[model samples]
Structure formats: C-alpha cells, structure tokens
Target: MKNPLILLALAATLSATAADAAEVPLYETGPAEDSSFVRFVNGGQQPLEIVATGSNARLTLDTAKPASDFLPIRAGKPIEGALVRGGAKRNVSVTVQPGEFASVVGLDDAAGGLRTVVVHEQPDDFNALKASVAFYNLDAQCASAALLAAGRNIVLLDQVPEGQSKRRQINPVPLSVQLSCAGQAVGQPLDLGTLEAGQRYTVFLVPAGKQSRIFQATDTVAR
Candidate 1:
C-alpha cells in the first residue's frame, strides 16, 4: 500500500532514533537534597546494634566488624535511636550539618554505661594520584595515638588524641603499619596490602583491656 523506498527510509529513521536514545546516559538514584552521611562504629567491647527511629534500617557492629557503611540522613535533624547490647537498650541522638559526614561511635563509659560520640569528618580535597587514610583514636587509655610504618621509623599519623581522628594522603603501595599509644606499641603490626590509588581507608585503635587493638577498613557508601 505504501512505497517500498519510503518504508525503508522510515525504518532507518526509527532505528537511528532508538540508537540515540540508548546512548543517552542513565544515572543512579542519589540521596535526598541537602542530605548528610552517617555511619556507626562499635568502639565498645561487645556487639552493638543501632535501631533507627521511624526507619527500618538496622546496623550491627562488633569487634570483628566494627564499622558500617555510610547511610544518608536528613541534615540538621537529630537522628534519634537506641543502642542495644545484650538485650539492654540506651537512647542516643546524633546530628550533623548539611553535606557533612559523621561517624557515631559507641563506647563503654567509665560508669559502665553505653555512650556515644559523634566524630565529624573533615572535608578533604581528593587526590586521584594518591590514597587517603584516616585514623580514629577510640582508646581512652591512650592519651595520644600514632601510626608508623612497620620495621621503619617513619610515622604516618602522630599525636592523635582520644575520641578524635586524623586523615592524610599517601602514595599507593603495599604497606604495613604499627599502632602505638602513649609512646608504646599497642598491638601486632597491621598488614595493609597493596593500596590502590583514589581509594579511601580507615584505621581504628579501639580499647582492649589495658592495651589497644587495631583494625583497618575500606570506606564505602550504602547504595
């Protein structure tokens, strides 16, 4: 009923249109506008559970896995929740600014109660040619903490006070480091094998009896 040459031309036009549409990029769904990021870290001796209010998100952390992936939350609003340990619950709240990143650390108080500390992460200018490392000092007995290259006298991070953190950018390479607190070595050397460029890392010095224990984790965001 239609001209054969006209039909072929129409088909080619439709195919080109479909191909152009497919080439258009599709982006992932991101966090809400003005949202901040927050993560949980268990600096205590026991397993910790975070039950968020009005949300179904539940995060658990223990000595073996002491950190959680970052989650998006409304900025400038207090996040009300409970920290549960061994069936015991303690109410906790944390707040952060818009576009900020924070870590909520659960610790054992001197009075034998569950407590929390919010550590705001300092903004950094990312370097694509280097690796970023952050050190968190959660050991109360350690007035100051330091991270040094194992078998070498070089210190990567030094004089980090208790309840705080410090970050630095370094060359990407296979490396090992030792944790020291109060001028004494705290634990066995930590082997951080073959760091890649543009990656981020975090090391924590958590309290363990009279001494301290060290662990490392790669920073990640919750999808």
Candidate 2:
C-alpha cells in the first residue's frame, strides 16, 4: 500500500500552491497624461504593496488608510500597474482621460481575496471663497448616510450609496461636519475649524467597532 505520510505531504504541497494562486498580484498598463491625477485607497483587511508601473511610483498601505493625494506622474502611454501582496502578483489595467481626476481603491472580495476598482472624480468650477469636498462610502456595513455642515441648511450629500463617492462645495469658514443615517446620528460631529479655499478634500467612511467612521485627505487638483 502507498505510504500515508507521503500522501499527506503531497496534499500539503498542493494546498500551498493553491493558496499562492488565490493571492496572486494583478497587473496592467495604459496610456496617461500629466493633466490627470491618480489617488490610491486601501479598504481591504490585508495590507498591500501598491506599485504604479510605467510611472515609477509605489506605496504600502494598510487597511482603511486615508486616501492619497493626487499624485503627479510622468505622462506615459501604456503605463503599467501592479498590486502585490503575500508574494503573489496580479496585473491591473487603468486608463485616465485628459483632465480626469481618478482614484483607485483596493477592497476585499467575497472570497477573502482582493478586488480593485477605479473611480473617476468629477470636476467643478473653483470657488475662490470656498473649499470643495468629496465623500466616498467604502464601509460594507454602512449602506448610506448624509453630510451636514454645522449651522447650515445644506445637505452636502444625501443617501450616499455604498462603494461610491459624492462631491459638494462648502464655504471656507469654521464649521462642523456631522453624519446621519436612518434618521439618527451615528457619532459626534467633526469640528473642522476652517477649510482652505481652492483646495480639494476627500473623505472616506470606514467600519469602526460596530459603527462607521471617517477619515479625510487633501487632493491636489490642477487649476
């Protein structure tokens, strides 16, 4: 009869190989221009090694890390990209139109792997006296929410759906921001002393201990 120990060892080797395939990195390449920008966000449970190929850029991001600012890259046609982790590799394909603002996010897949999506940001006329902000709903548990500017009747965003982002313009003044869901407040309002005019910001809502929370980052937009 075949040795049981040998069979067990073979099974272990095959299992390890399957695991590696499940975590392989994704890669791709595309044309791009300087008028465009690329922002990165990590929403997956496992950390990742972010590599922007054909552009010479890389970043290491952990779970729920704040969105990266619009990063400038040398305009290149057929630019390559890759997301690597656990010694596995996968190729990513991306294309940015001229004057386009975009963000790429890493998310968790249903199978405990990684899923990536590219978000095209909307552009608006600059308000020299106000600041613009964008909100992205990435929390799997938070279906929707609203953004209220303190003392203002403005609803910056209403029913922002999950896995998407919304933008609004706010006055460059001291104010607090609050979030509400299902007709009730989730947490304390954030006191933003004042926002700088002509600057852009992006906020991400993430899961935190049975509740959803937020983190903000500045974005560099070309005039």
Candidate 3:
C-alpha cells in the first residue's frame, strides 16, 4: 500500500471563510500522450481494480509528465492520501467512478513546463500484459509451461498398441503412461497385453520439475 506522491499537490487548505478564493487545479484529456485519464490494467489482485472499467481507469496526480514514465502507482485499495514533491504542498484525491476529471495541482505552465498530467506511477499490482505461466502435472502426459524449461519443451508421447488380433480381444484401456525426460525416456506404460474383463487402468501425475510440465487431459479410452 504505497502512497501516491505525485498526485496530491499539498495545497494549503484554509476554510472558505478565511480565504476569499480557493483555486481548484485543472487539466485536459485531449493529447495522445494525455488521453484525458491514463489507462492501466490491474494484473494483480487489487480491490480498487473493481471500479476501473474502460480507458478511463486512472490514479490522479500532480506530476507534469505521464506517471508511467516518471513514477507509478500500484494497484490496491482506493487511495485518498496525497504526496508532496518538488516544493509543492500537494494533496491528491482519487476515485474509481468515471466521467469526472480532476486537475493536477502542481502542473501549471505559469511556473514552468511542469509536464504533469493526471496520472500516478504504475501500480505494482497491475501489468500491461495478457498472460502468465500456469502450472500443471506431467506424468507420462504432455507437460505445460509449469514443467517446461524456460517456458518451453520438446515432450514426446509414444505408445505401442497391441496388434490387430489382440486389439480385438478385450477392452481398449491403456496399461500405463510413459515419459521422455531430458534426453532419455524414464519409464514405459505397463503393457495391457490382451484386455481382461472389466479391469480399468488408472493414471497418476508425477512432477517433472517444481514448475515444469503442463498437464493436458485426454479421453482416449472413450475414443
């Protein structure tokens, strides 16, 4: 739950009664770089992610440049606090609700080209990515990324079916599964020989590596 330092310009807040005027910061969402509210994907599990719907998902800030290029916000519970950066009394406010916009306080060109737009630093919780490695068991079956080295593998599944004369005898149940590990085939499937009665062969999964081998399900017996 890191705080967003660039969004909240710590503007001195005096009661409206004490001051005749209070300035509310302002900005636009027109520029390609400043497409209004910056969009982000919550790759990690964050509660705030529940609200960001479309291209408007954002964490407002006072930095002059896109927060992704400078600093970024991590996905988490909605942040209401602010950060003080570059000698500015900054106070940042944010919400998941869409259609409304907030002005980045410290980013006024009058002082200088403080390229601040309404974006916070990238949130550690989310990523601009689509997929990640998922785990599975690879007993004599195909191993997935979970078992594949460097996220890939050259797994082989070879079987020796009985001759047609024996194939016509009993059932078509598989006796055992085999696996080729490294450069060697570690084991072989038990020979079902001639299928006997209602006997069924059960299969089990063994790990090739902690994160090796992807598991794929098959219904060959039914086939």
Candidate 4:
C-alpha cells in the first residue's frame, strides 16, 4: 500500500497543476467578427495627430501622406480621441455600424479651428479582373471636384461635392490624372503608376494654402 502522506502530497500537486492549466487561456482574444474599421485623413493644411481613447496607438497625417491605414474598433461604439495640431487640441469622435468602414477627416473650420467630418461606406466589393479607384473631395473650397485623365477629356470621376466620395471600377492600366474644382483646374497632373488587378486606390483633393492639392494612397485592410 502507498504511504498516506505521500499520496496526499501528490494529490495536492496534481490539483495545483490542474488549477494553473485552467487559468491559462487556450487562445488569445481577437477583434470581434462584427467589428467596424476607421481611418484618419488630414484635409487641412497643417499636419494632424490623433490619440484614441483606451489605446496607445497614434495616427499622424501630413501633406506627404494624407491618410492612415484602417484600424478595427467595436461596432456602434464611438471611438473618441483628441485631435492635435501643433500645440492645439480638440475632441473628436466617430461611430460606424458593424462591418462598415469610416474615414474621419480633419478639416479647417470657419473660425480657422479644426473640425471633423465622418465618411462611411460598406466594405469594398468589386470585380476581381479590374482595379478599383475612389475619389474623395475634402476641400471645402472645392464646391464640385472632377477627376480627369491627364492630357485628355476622359473624365473618370466628375462633379463630386465637398466632403463626398465616389468610387468606380477600371481596367488595370497606367494613367495620369488631374483635379478640377468648380470648372477650374486646381493642381498639376498626377501620374498614377500602373494599376494592378484586384487592388484598390484612393485619391484625395485636400485644401492647401489658399489652393488645393491632390494626394494618392493605396487602400489596404488590417489582417
């Protein structure tokens, strides 16, 4: 027969090991399936920074790079943050439905302060054989923004109003584009390198010093 104290000690060790196993998680938790996505765009002349609540992540936007990649957040919950430009700070919030994508843009307010505009859209769906392009008119001075093929009258996107965006599918090809606002060209032509099939692109018409400039970025999703 086994010694009683020895068996008791062995049993106690087994129990403690079982308890530790129970405390350990089998897998790490990830974002929920119904989570939404959000990104930041700086439409104003000055560079902007965003510090979201409950997160240490910081998103910065400037003239060279006007948009940030999307980040996932809980659906229907407002993602509140502080928008910082130089020494000034202002509160901002954005909300979106489950499975939706949103862009929170910082624009120049009438008082020369910073204001925000939220643009929402469903997850992108497009033909696999073609590329997708979107145009966002965030320049308040541009009442109607139009995108055209450079050196040609070919209009890709036309008559987009301020704070609005439009998307279309196009055959994969190299192209140069120009921005015209309210029937007048705002900036010089921009060369969009060869577009690839199944890829996404976005062009933004943002405000500059008393004029407007165009920015381009490839759209991507977080894994």
lDDT of 1 at 111: 64
Quote model 4's TM-score: 0.78
Count: clashes, candidate 2: 11
Q: State the displacement of the C-alpha of residue 44, model 4, in Å, after optimal TM-score superposition.
A: 3.2
Per-residue error (Å), model 3, residue 59? 13
Q: Using TM-score as the measure, which candidate wins? A: 1
The per-residue C-alpha lDDT of model 2 at residue 87 equals 56
lDDT of candidate 3 over 61-100, digit per residue (tens) = 2212111211112222233443233343233354322322
Error of 1 at 175 (Å): 2.0
Supply the global lDDT for candidate 3.
0.23
* Candidate 2 structure quality by residue, lDDT tens digits, 1-223: 2111100111121011111112111110122334555656665546776665444345666744444445433322333467766655556766656666667776655555666767776464456666778877766676557777645646677676777788877877776777766656667776756677766677767665467776666664211
Give lDDT tens digits, candidate 1, residues 32-82: 347676777887779998776655446667877777656556677776777
Descending-lDDT candidate ranking: 1, 4, 2, 3
TM-score of candidate 2 on Cα atoms, chains taken together: 0.66
Query: What does candidate 3 score on TM?
Result: 0.18
Report residue 196 deviation for candidate 2 (angstroms): 0.4
Which candidate would rank higher by lDDT, 3 or 4? Answer: 4
